[model samples]
Structures are given as structure tokens and as C-alpha cells.
Target chain A: MKKLLLAAALSALATGAAWADTVRLGTEGAYPPYNFINDKGEVDGFERELGDEICKRAALDCTWVTNEWDSIIPNLVSSNYDAIIAGMSVTAERDEVIDFTNEYIPPSPSGYVGLAGGSVDVAKGIIAAQINTIQAGHVASSGATLVEFASPDETVAAVKNGEADAVLADKDFLAPIVAESGGMLAFIADDVSIGGGVALGLRESDGELKAKMNTAIDAMKADGTLNTMLVKWFKDAAPQW
Target chain B: MFEICAEPRSLEGLTWLSCYLTTPKHAAMYYSILTVLGLLLAVVPPILFLGFAGALARRSKIAPVRWLGVGYTSIVRGVPDIVFFLFFPIALDQAVEYIRHKIKCADVLEPVYQGNDFVVCQAAKMPLGIADQFYHEAWGFSLAVITFAIVFGAFTANTLHGALNAVPKGQLETARAFGMSERQTFWRVHMPQMWVYALPGLSNLWMILIKATPLLFLLGVKDIVYWAKELGGMKTQVYTYAHPDWRIWYFGALLVFYLFLTWVSQRAFDRIFARASRGLSVAS
Candidate 1:
């Protein structure tokens, strides 16, 4: 009876773990087009549709979890979730901590958006980017003062408030904001590409799960479905898969 | 709002402002303040009850109960409270779902410890797999509350234990001389008298609880802080309302909100202490 009880308890813990089929896909639901919380408050956007297709083809039970952008990668390392589908680009600094599957969305250009007549000097003027993002890296190296904010909205806000002379972010992301600025803001510089294109980040140890997801992602890339999504959401800014 | 919002770009000054504040997301931010208030009101009663149990257990003659109570109180003090706040919800959620998964899917032969992932059966998912948005939010909120109650309960227990000791020995002896049993003496004499002593510490605990509501953001709940960040940032042309970086303004509003809450709390605690101390001697 004691041995049986011990076995049951151990199996109970094993049973509770992902030893089952479901994979929890973690994303920051704050970014638009890539991923955002919709009016119904569910995760919606390009990645949502694309991630669903990957799960469908890969034959894995996938669930969506939204985590804060700043801690998304660390949370995956700590086993809070299995994968990060957040709009994170592949960067050398991050590669030290987590592994990437493959380039799903090819690296697109990043641009600087500033007040229409008050362009940031780029050499010395303060520039803002969302915290831990690749654009922040480019700003850090470009001889401009770098300011970081927790969310993309705040980065744009920094430019509007004069806290930042300009905000460096994905061109596609800043395009709509500039259009909405109604002549208040405009692109101040040429598009500068940074990092490899965005990819799914997994724990370094999650090789099997990574293999499964990569297969699904590669399949998406093969049939032009990936480009279809890129065009639908990113329009002219999308790079061909 | 209907009129001012019509030509968002054309309007300026306070007219533009009126429409901006009335955006649907701003309304959600306002409602989130009430959510924080609701959490405060809901968690306190249970915390007090837990404290009462802990104090009694500590005072009990039984050796293990006293040790258990002592352990509960002392252990929480050495570790930072915020650690508990951060750790509890995720751990508890997994633990709860884990238990449910075991019973619901007994025949499953595979191990659950897949790397970096914790997968459970579909039916065992909390709020179930297809729960509404409200259910999901409420479930997360509930986990946050329980985490707060448990962590704060330990602090409250320590305070109540000290308060229990502060009650005069003469009062207990007098109650016993008047034919009161141990249980009766506790209920009739010790518990009532201890309140005057406990009120000051409990009030301090209450303030900490009030200030700590901001930590709900860490638990992934869309509390006031989350909404403030979401709604205050500049909205571009695509949004119905657009603005420049207004974070300083939004955060200023939040600072005032918390200040008002703390001010009211201080006044109410002062009144509570005054009433509780009504008949006690000045020295006592």
C-alpha cells in the first residue's frame, strides 16, 4: 500500500506537467499587427493566425498566454511557459540566453520617426525604443542618447513629449503612428535594418519542442502562406520569405 | 464626448481633452481602480480570521499547533513579502491545475515534465479551455487575492500573537475566578481586550496592503497601473483619439489616486483606533 501510494503521488506530479500534448505559446499582447489584445480582449493579430496554423500543422495542442514584454524571454527560461511568440527579433545578445527556431518574418528595416520640423540629430539627440528591443541596440550604438520605455506606445509618446527627439522602431510599426500624427511626426532618416528577422524563441533545452515548431514554421514559409500574412498585415514593408 | 470626438484632429484645448478622456480604454482604466478597491475590501476579512486562528494556535498548549503557528509567522518575516507576492500565484495556479489534471486524466502514461512547458488536459484547464474573457480575468484576479491574503495573513498573525500577549494576565485570572472556562475566558476577556492593543499594528498592516495593490501588475492582472500605461500613451491616426506622450500626466493622475486612497485610509484608521480605545485607561 505504501509503495503504491508513493508511485501514485509521483505519477500525479508527472501527470500535471506538460508530459501531455499541449504547448503554451507566450507572447506580449501589446504590439499591434504582430500581436495585440483585441476589443474582445483575446490575443489577435498576424502571429495569432500564423501561430494557430503552425499548431494545426504541427499537430500540437497550443494555448496562448500573454506575458509582459520585458520579462517574456526570462519567463520561458524559468518554465513559466514553453515558447515566446512575441515580436522578438533574433539578436546576438539574446541568442546567448535563448534559442531561436528560424526566421519566420524576414528582417525588415527599422526607421526613425520624429516631430515633423524638429528632427532628432541622431548623432547626439535622445532617441527612444521599447525596452530590450533590437532598435534600442541600434540607437545605443549610433552615438545618440538612448531612452527605453516598457511598451511601444511609450516610445512613441517619448517623441511626442520631447523627452525623445525621435523614436527608433520597426518601420512598419511606426508607419501607422506617423500617418496618424497628422503632420505632427514624420520619418527623419532612411530605413536601417537591424537583427535577423523575427523568430520563435524557445528554451535552449527545448530541442524536441523546437524541432516540432521549426518544422511547422518551415512549412509555413514553403507554401507562400507566410508571405501572404506579411503582405496582409505589413503591406509594402514586408520582406519576401 | 459625442460632439468633441467628431473631428478629433480639428479640435484642440479642453474640447479635444473631453473627448480624449471618454475613450473606451480610459473607461476601463477608471473601472480598474474599483477592482483594486474590491480586492482590498475582499481580502481583509479572511486575513483577520486567519490571523485569529494563528494567534490561538500559538497560544494553545498543544506543542505541534504552537510550533506550526510560530513557523507560519516567523518564516514569512525572514523572506521579503514581495517575493511571496510574485511567487504564489503562478505556483498556486500550477499546483491547482496539476491536481485537477491527475484526477481527470488518470490513464495518461506520458510524463508531464516536458522542458519549459507545463501541459495539462483540456478539461482540466482552469476556467476550462473555452471560458469567456471575464472568467479568465476573474480567475487571475482570484489567484492574486488568495496570494495576498495568505502572505498578509502571516504578518497579521505575528501582530495578533504579540497583541494576545499584551493583554493583562489579571483580566484572564479574573474571568477564571468568575467561573469562566478557558475557552470562555478567551472569548469573553482575552480576545476583546487584545483588540485595543492589536489595532495599531493591524492599521500599519492595512496600509502596507493598500500600497501593495500595485504589485498586481506583476501577477499579470490588468490593474490600474496596466490601464494607465495602456491608455495614456500617444494614440496615432488609426485610433479614435490621438495625443502626444501624456505619461507624465497619466502617472500624475495615478499618484493622486493612490494619495487619496491613503489619505482616506489614515482618517478611517484614526477613527477606528479612537472607538476601540474608548474605555481603556490612558496608560493601558
Candidate 2:
């Protein structure tokens, strides 16, 4: 009877492992082009498409989860999600906490979009950006205030509220903020940009999962799926890198 | 022989520091932030009072009053503050404009909500068409204060209502037997005693209010958090004091400032607690 009970427990564990197909993914849904929520409350944009493609390639069924940007890393550490597909930039500090797949989107020029004013020459001074942007590294010497925020919305709101003179964001993301500024703010020259591009990440413990993602990303780039989605979101101003 | 204050140096350390600190515009902003903090402190009290009324109404004998009070507190608590901070200012601004739109542009026939855009007659703009930049700032501050008050007030009301019920029922009965009116008894006996019970909760609410001042940046008021970020970034060759990324230091200073504020408030609350409990002695 004891042998029969032990066998039953092993079989139950195997069945549970076989039936699990869910891959919880997390992202800051407020950022556009990378990831954003549409008016209909559905998550869409480049990151979603990339995540779906990667899941298909890896043969893992996945669902994307919206999480606060500051909490994303901690949540992953706590096993809240198996993966993060947010437009997270790879940096030495963040790399210390999580393992990232190889460079997917390369660096793009980053700068601020603000109102046309003598108070801020977006070309000249301190700036604000979503936390963890490469533009932060470049603008460190610009003598301009570098206000870091968790969401693209907060960065843009900083501009609107006049708390931030300008924002350091992708040229694509800045376009919406500029348009919405309603003449209160405008973008400086786009030639003065900073930041490499975004990346998908996972907890460092998940080394095997990282390898599968790199394979999927390579397939997406090779098959032109990445470029197609890039054009759909970025349009004429898409980063060439 | 050393020169003793004979030739004025182009920009000495003290002179540069003095000029930077004394700049007229900078001075104005220094005082302006204090005004903003004062505005915040001044505006929050009425909200607490309103919240108390709402909580009492929710606990009222009348069903409708109780439902209204319950609905207000629960709905505010349910939604994330980010949503309320985003929604309230815009909603209030639009609501005010709609009223003005009716008054000033009654003949206009275009619908207000037109495909994600809210269009109102130019004449209906709050503060009218000719207001200056300062007017806009004042209006924004007003909106922020109201939003903070409303949100925090609900929490205060919940605290106060609990304190009200905790008052010993025998005290009220004695007051009634002595021919005191209900209103007089509430003011003379119940209200004064409620503070003793309410102090702990009220003190916690004060800390929440203090920590929440940073959210004023979200509302568009340039409080110290905004300035700290602005001043703390590295300046290049163009500026006199060039440096590297110094945001960590700036944020560190802000953390200290907040910590100090909390510490001072905690000390003050302890004194008040002791003073309130002066006559009563617990077993040593």
C-alpha cells in the first residue's frame, strides 16, 4: 500500500508539470512603440508582437502582464512572472539583477521633446527620461537635469506640468508627447538623440530560458518579422539602428 | 608680499556661491515653494472636516446618507491614486469649463466629447481668455490642493468616525441628564475627548500627507522634488560647476529631508499624546 501511494504521488507530479503551459510576461504598458495599452484596453505594439513571436518560436504559451516599472525587477525576483518583455534597456546595474538576451534593438539617438522656449534649449541642457535609458549616460555631462521616471506617461506628464524641461525618450515615443503638448511644448532637433534600443529580460536563474529566447529573436530578425513590426509602429521616423 | 583683498578676483568661490544663492529668480522660487507647502497645509484641514461629515453621514440613521458616505469612501479607496491624480484635475477642469460653456456659449451646438477630443468654446475656458501665467499657476495649485484634500480627507474621516464611536456612552448619558443639548454635549465633552483616541490615527495620516507631497510633481506643481532633480544633474563645461551624474546624491538629500520631517513630526506627536493623557495614569 505504501509503494502504491508513492507511485501515485510521482504520477500526479508528472501530470502537473506536463499540463502547465502558461508563461507570465510583464511589461510597462504605458510606453508606446515598445508596449502600450490601446483605447480598448488591449495591450498592443512592438513588444507584444515580439513577445508573441518569441513564444511561438520557443513553443511556450505566454500571456503578457502589465506591472509598475519600478516593481518589475522585484516582481520577477519574487517569481511574479517568468519573463519581462518591456522595453528595458540593458545596463550594467540592471544586468547585475537579471540576465538579458543578446542585443535585439540596437542603440538609437535619444533627446527631449519640450515646449519652444528660451527656458529650455532641449539641445543644450538637463533632461528627463523613463528610468534606465542610455540617453541618461550621454546627457550626464549636458549639465541638464536628468529626471528619471518609471513610465513614459510620467515622463511626458513632467513635461506637461513644466516640472521637466524636456524628456529623453525614443524619437517615436516623443512624437506623441510633442503632438499632445498642444503647443505648450515641442521637440528639439532629432539629430541630437541618445540611448541604444530596448531588450527582453528574464531572471538570471533562468539561463535555459534565455537561450531559447535568443534563438527565437534570431529567427524573427532573419525572417524580417522584426523589421515589419518596427515599420508598423515607427513609420517614417523609425530608428535605422 | 601676499595681496590682502586688494584686487578682486574674477569669480572667487564665495562670490560665485553668493551670486548663485542671491539671484533674484532663484530667490523667488525658493519662497514660492514655501508658499506652495503653506498652500498645501492650509488647504488640507477643510478636506478633513468634509471627510468627517461624509463618514458620519455614511454612519447616519438615514439610509441615503449612509449609502452616500459608504460610496464615497469605498470608491476612492478602490481606485489607484495614480488614476485619481490623473482623473480629478482634468475632470474638475472640464466640469468647470462645461458650466462656463453653458453660461457663455449657450447658442453653440457642437457636442463636447467629439472622438477622444474635448472641445469647448474658447470663451468658456476656466479663468477666462485673458488670464496671465500666474493665474494658470494658481489655478493648477488650487486643483492639486483640492485633489489632495479629497483623497486624504476620506482617510481622516474614517479615523475620526471610529474615534467618535469609541467615546464612552456613559459620558454622553451624564451630559444629557444634566440638561445639556446634544450639540453642546458633543462640543463640550465628546469632541475634546475624541482627540485622545484619534491622535494615533491622525498622526499616521499626517505622515501619509507628508510623503504624498512628492506626488505634487505629478500634478504639475514644481515642489522640492522637482527642483532637486533639476539642480542635481551633472552640468557640463557650459555651466560654472561641471560634474558627473549626481542624481543619487540629490535623491539621497531628498530622502534625508523626508526622514527629518518624519522624525520631527513623530517627536511633536509624542508630546501632544503626553499632554492629552496628562490627567489619566495607567498602572506604573
Candidate 3:
């Protein structure tokens, strides 16, 4: 009886190892449209839908994991998840540590939003951006005093409370706030085109997984499903193929 | 979790709140309260053990042992707790990975610290690259516990050391005059009398430890404070549970939780102090 019990436990462990093969996709669930935790508390947004479709097309079992924005890249490298589909923009500095799949979302303009009727001198005034983002890197180098925030919401909050002269972020993310602010917030400066577009980030060591994801992304692009998703999530602000 | 939760945007009143509080994310927040308690329970044994060890070492006859204990208590107590909380976990993680890299990747020629990155072979990861998610979380939590133990242990050492001295010198001298060895007197007499003096300081330390649980979020443990911030942020119509910024309400809830915990702790400590101080004339 003891031997039989040991065998049963060993079989259970084997099945557990097999079930661990599912690919895990990581995202920051705080950013809306790109990603956000819905009322059901599941990861829901453009990236969520796109990641699921890609997994289905590639014939791979996948699960979602939420991580803080600042540590997203490090966590991916440390193998916390198989991929980062958190609307991360492709940049040369990031390319050194991790590899990227082909672009899923086209390059979009980043705009500065400030209080209505206020003039923001982009060159000299303090601008807010989420830390470790391409926009933050741009703000830091664009001759502006950059105040970095941990979350995207804090950047917008900084602008509303007059802690910053303006908050610069992706136009798609900023557009909805501008529309809903009742004329309290408006675009204060010309949009700046930055980054090489957004894509799925993967560990450099995971070549096979990277190839499979790239194939699925290409299939989505070819069938216009990716474009449909972009429009649905970003409305008219989405840059199309 | 309920059928009505399917359309959260349409939710209203108590029904909406029930669904809101029962979401998976909210469930995680509820579980994090237990995480804070678990850390407190798990840390106490190590803290007391280290405190006793440190206090004894300082009283050692050997000069080196005495210096080691003195250095530990003085150095750790001198640094700000927040700096130690932030620095220890990352430094310890890298140190573990670095040692593993040296052993597992002996043939690799590139340095471990290249430019800004700490590159290690996939096999050298602390939990191993293919380990389960449960292992990853457990690893983070264990690191948080150790950091807490180390910082709190130093303060505990100082309190225990003071208590050891505060045990009236006449009592220990009387034991020595009765032909008792120093070790026998320390274990049987001095240790028993030391508790009366230690209870007050230890109670203060316990309250501080309870308050420090919120800092677990800094070490990436997903404690209650992290969830409060995430759930309280503004949500637009695109989200299922659309709500305005409700951070004030969430923070208010945290305030009540902390006050209740401290209140319960205070009552328990009062009882323990009363019982321990029984025949002694020490103020309760």
C-alpha cells in the first residue's frame, strides 16, 4: 500500500510538470486600453485580446500575469513570464537586454496635456512622464525638467494639480482624458513622434518562443484582425497599417 | 464572482459592492492581510533567537565575540530602516545569483556585471528559470521576511542587552557568592529577572513592527498598500467597474485596519506584562 501511494504521488508530480509548459504573458494592468484590470479583476484591454488571439493562432497554452511597470522588463529577463505584451514601445536602449517581436501597434504621436488655456514651454518647464518609458527618456533629453511618476495615472494627476507644467504620454492614452475633462485639460504643445512602435518583448534566450510569436503576429497583420483590434481599442487615434 | 458581476458597469448599490469586493484582485488584497500577519508570525522566532544570541555575545568573555555583537547592534540600529528595507533584498538577490553564476557558469568568459546588467546563465536564477509561479512568489516573500528579521533583530538586541544589565547587579552578585557559576546564574536567575525590564521595550518594538508591514510593497511583496493604490485609481467607462478616484475611501479603510490591529496587540501585551510582572514591584 505504501509503494502504491508513492507511485500515485510521483504520477501527480509528473502531470504537474507537464502542465507547467503553458506560456505566461506579463502586462501592467493599470494602463487602460493597452491593459487594465477590469471589474471582474481579470487583465482586459487591447494587449489582453491581442495576446490571447496570438496564443490561439500559435496553438500554445498561455496565461496572463500582472506586474508593476517599473520592474516589467527586469521580471521578464529574470523569467517571471515568457513574454511582455504590456504596450511597451521598441527602443534601442531596451533592445540591448531583450528581443522584440515585429510591431503589433504602429508608431503613434506623444502629446503634452496641461490645464486649458495655459501655455507650456516644452523646452524649459517641468514635464511629467511615467518612469522608465520612452516618453520619460524623451522628456529628459528634450531640454525639459522631467518629473518621473511610478504610474501613468500619477502623471495625469500631476498635470491636474499643477505640479507639472504638462504631462507627455501616448496620444491614445491622453486623448480619452482630454475628451472627458470638461475642457479642464487640453493639448498644450505639438505632438512628438518617438519610439519604433510597440511590440511583444521576449527573453533573448527564448528563440523558439520568439519565432512562434512573430509568426502569429504576422498572421494577424495579414488577415486585418490586428487593424480591427487597434481601431476598436484606440478609436480614430490608432495608427493603421 | 456572482451572475450580476457579468455587467459591472450596470451594477449599483450593495449588490454592486458585493461583486466589487469579491473580484479576484480584491481577493488577492484580502489574502495580503494574511501575508502581513504571516510575516509577523514567521519573523518573531528568528528575531527573538537573534536578539538573545546578540545579547549573550555582547556579554561574552572573548574580546572578538563581544566586538561582533556590538558592531551588529550599533551598525544596523544606526542606519535608517527604510534604506535597509530598500537595499537588502536587491543586494541579497544579486549576491545569491552571483554565487550561483560562479558555480554554474564557470566556462563563460564575460564578467557578471557588464555595463548596467547582471548577466547570469538561465540555470543560475535563484528559483531556477523553469520553476513554478508559486516558487517565484515564495522566493520574494522569504526575502522580505529575512530583511524584516535582520532590521528588527538589531533593535531587539539593544532592548535585550539593556534588560540584561537592568536585572539588579546585587542579585547576580548574590548568586555568585552562593558558589553558583556564571553560566548557572545567567540561565536560572538573571534570565528570569531580565524579562520584567525587557517587556516594556519589546512591546514598543512589536508595535513598530506591525506598522512596518506596509513597507512590504517596497520589496515587491504585493501587500495591502499596493492593492489599495491600484484599486482606488480612477476608472473610465471602458473598464467594467467604472468609478471616479476612490483612493480616499480605500485609504480610510486601511486606517481602520491598522488601528484595530494595534488595539488588539496593545490589549494582549498588557495582559502578558501583568502576568510576567507578578511578584515583582515593577510598574505594570
* Candidate ordering by TM-score (highest first): 3, 1, 2
Candidates ranked, most accurate by DockQ first? 3, 1, 2
Best model number under TM-score = 3
State how far residue B123 of model 2 sits from its true place (Å): 2.0
- Stretches of candidate 2 above 4 Å error? A1-241, B1-12, B23-29, B238-241, B278-284
Model 1 chain A poorest 10 in a row by lDDT:
A11-20
Lowest lDDT 10-residue stretch of candidate 3 chain B? B114-123
> Which regions of candidate 1 deviate over 4 angstroms?
A1-26, A36-65, A73-84, A91-102, A111-149, A155-168, A174-193, A200-237, B1-19
Give the least accurate 10-residue stretch of model 1 chain B, judged by summed lDDT. Answer: B235-244
Better of 2 and 3 by DockQ: 3
Stretch of 10 with least lDDT, candidate 2 chain B? B1-10
**B73-168 in candidate 1: lDDT tens per residue?**
778766787788767787888888788778877777655555545666565677554444476678888998888888888889989999989988
Give the RMSD in angstroms, all C-alphas superposed, for model 3: 4.3
RMSD of each: 5.8, 21.7, 4.3
Superposed by TM-score, candidate 1 places the C-alpha of residue A235 at a distance from the truth, in angstroms, of 5.8
- A106 in model 3: Cα distance from truth in Å? 1.6
Residue A104 lDDT in model 1? 91
**After superposition, candidate 3 runs with Cα above 4 Å error:** A1-22, A117-119, B78-83, B90-132, B282-284
For candidate 2, what TM-score does chain B get against the true chain B? Answer: 0.85
